[model samples]
Target: MTASKTLNVGDKAPDFHLPDAEGRMISLSDYRGVPVVVYFYPKDDTPGCTAEACAFRDQYEDFKQVGAEVIGISSDAPDRHARFAGKHRLPFVLLSDQDGAVRKAYGVAATFGILPGRVTFVIDRDGVIGHIFSSQFRATRHVSEAIDVLGRLA
Candidate 1:
């Protein structure tokens, strides 16, 4: 039984308050007035996931210049997340969903989806979801596409 709804474009983004690597609580509501790119991945350290993270890291400034924040979410524990972030020098926050609550809430939590299929949600400043990208091969491009979509919306 999947708890995720088929989130549509323009839908209100589901609010969440999860802990970051440093154990700081990060909430979706906190970024309400700014465009947000929330991406879900499977684990902390992996090839595809690493590529995806590095891609975002590489363009971290572009997203910021465009007035957007990127957040990566996964079921990894805080310790693992901390290691991954430090290893990659990721500038964005990576939320820890240890129990998969956030994942299930977003409907991307899957068993076979072990290597969580890439799902990126681009949310507008008003906290409304503007676009959803569901593709693994294009995971690295998710951030760029999200910035483009959010730029148009802005």
Candidate 2:
């Protein structure tokens, strides 16, 4: 399949329908009319991924206050996502991208052509991307960057 161009700020965020931790179908359209933070991580329960997930968990209230939804997506199975979320007490949704199709649709590239890319997209209420941050190592910063952009949108 041909690769789509990487999405950028001002572009329309691609709409997707995926299953969450409990196997409940969740669509990006389900969250329209409110800002959304969609982060694609490498995997569930890995050291860096855990740190990033926990960072979002800690500031989940801040995101909620602004009426923004935070979603973490990885190729991990729904069961592992459920475990990861439960173990960290995460209050946000974690979606499973089993085939990495959504990842490619969003143009979340791999690091060194191997590992899944750690990228975060901040979409405004109108479903337009407001900001995009990608960093493989500084995973926690994705949460901060997303929150910062969401604040500006608010």
Which candidate leads the pack in lDDT? 2
Write the residue-wise lDDT of candidate 2 on 1-154 in tens digits: 2355778899988888899999999999999899999999999889999999999999999999999999999999999999999999999999998988899989999999999999999999999999999999999999889888888888
Model 1 residue runs over 4 Å out of place are 1-3, 109-113
Q: In every candidate, how many clashes are there?
A: 1, 0
Task: Please give the CA lDDT of all the candidate structures.
Answer: 0.85, 0.92
Q: Can you write out model 1's per-residue Cα lDDT over 10-32, one digit (the tens) per residue?
A: 78888898999999999999998
Q: Once all C-alphas are superposed, what RMSD does model 1 give against the true structure?
A: 2.1
| TM-score of model 2 (CA atoms) | 0.97
* Residue 58 C-alpha lDDT in model 2: 94
Candidate 1: the clashing residue pairs are 4-107
Candidate 1 least-lDDT 10 residues: 108-117
